[model samples]
Target: MNRLMEFIATGFYSGKLPKMPGTWGSILAAILLYFLWPTNLKFQLLIIFITFILSVISADYVAKELGNKDPDCVVIDEILGMEIALLGLSADIKTVFLGLILFRVIDIMKPPPIGFFEKLPGGLGITVDDAVAGVITNVILRLIGGLL
Candidate 1:
């Protein structure tokens, strides 16, 4: 069970990378978002819903197991964050790649409410900040796309 939690939490072990595991996890999440992306928007929403639920549970357990409030290697948060970032966007190179960069930037920056959410309890703290970052990135993308 621990092994499975570890696997899921690590974003398929991308989190185990020697450096910048969060970055690696986000990269993996972007690639995953590309492949898992579907034409039906409902399926995309479902994917985010399911991944978010799983991320919360697994993140909590992994934190408990690893004895860290927010273990760097547990990047289910990144997976869900990236998923949220590209929610309504297409899987094209521009959308996926740009979303990756944007999400990473917002996630790393953690401005205002993003940092506030990061201070929440346990796994909620770990995931909420990234999720908000994704949402912000999505809004920015939509706004930019609208102006174009």
Candidate 2:
């Protein structure tokens, strides 16, 4: 059970990548999630809500076991966050690419409440910060979508 927990906590082997595995896994997850986008806003919201909840719990446990705060290997949070960022956007490749870039930038920069949220303890901190970053990315995407 311990081994199983570690494996799941480590993102089912995605975390074992030699370099930037989490980022790569997140990119892949976002790409996959883009294909799963529902036309209905309510459904999208439900997916995002459930994913966020699971990510917070799982990421926290992973970080604790890995002895780090928001370890790079624990990227389920990023996957969930990026999925949230892409919500309600057009399914075009261009929109997805733009959202991906925007999400990565906002996540890396950790602006405002994102930065504030990073100070939180445990997995809540790990996941919340990325969630805030995702919200920022979503806002930017929405603004751009409005303009174009």
Q: Go through the candidates in order and give each one's C-alpha lDDT.
A: 0.87, 0.76
Worst lDDT 10-window in candidate 2: 1-10
TM-score of each: 0.95, 0.88
Off by over 4 Å in 1: none
Q: Which candidate is the best by TM-score?
A: 1
> For residues 14-128, could you state the per-residue lDDT of candidate 2 as single tens digits?
7668897766756766677668777788988897788677777777777777778877777777777787787787657887788788888788777787888888888788778
How do the residues 37-136 of candidate 1 rate in per-residue lDDT, one tens digit apiece? 8868899899888888778888889899888999999888998888888887888888889899988888888887898998888878888888899899
**Candidate 1 has what TM-score?**
0.95
At residue 58, give the lDDT of candidate 1.
84
Best by lDDT: 1
Q: What shift in Å separates residue 96 of candidate 1 from its native position after superposition?
A: 0.6
Q: Which ten residues in a row have the lowest lDDT in candidate 1?
A: 32-41
- Assess the local accuracy of residue 34 in candidate 2 as a C-alpha lDDT between 0 and 100: 68
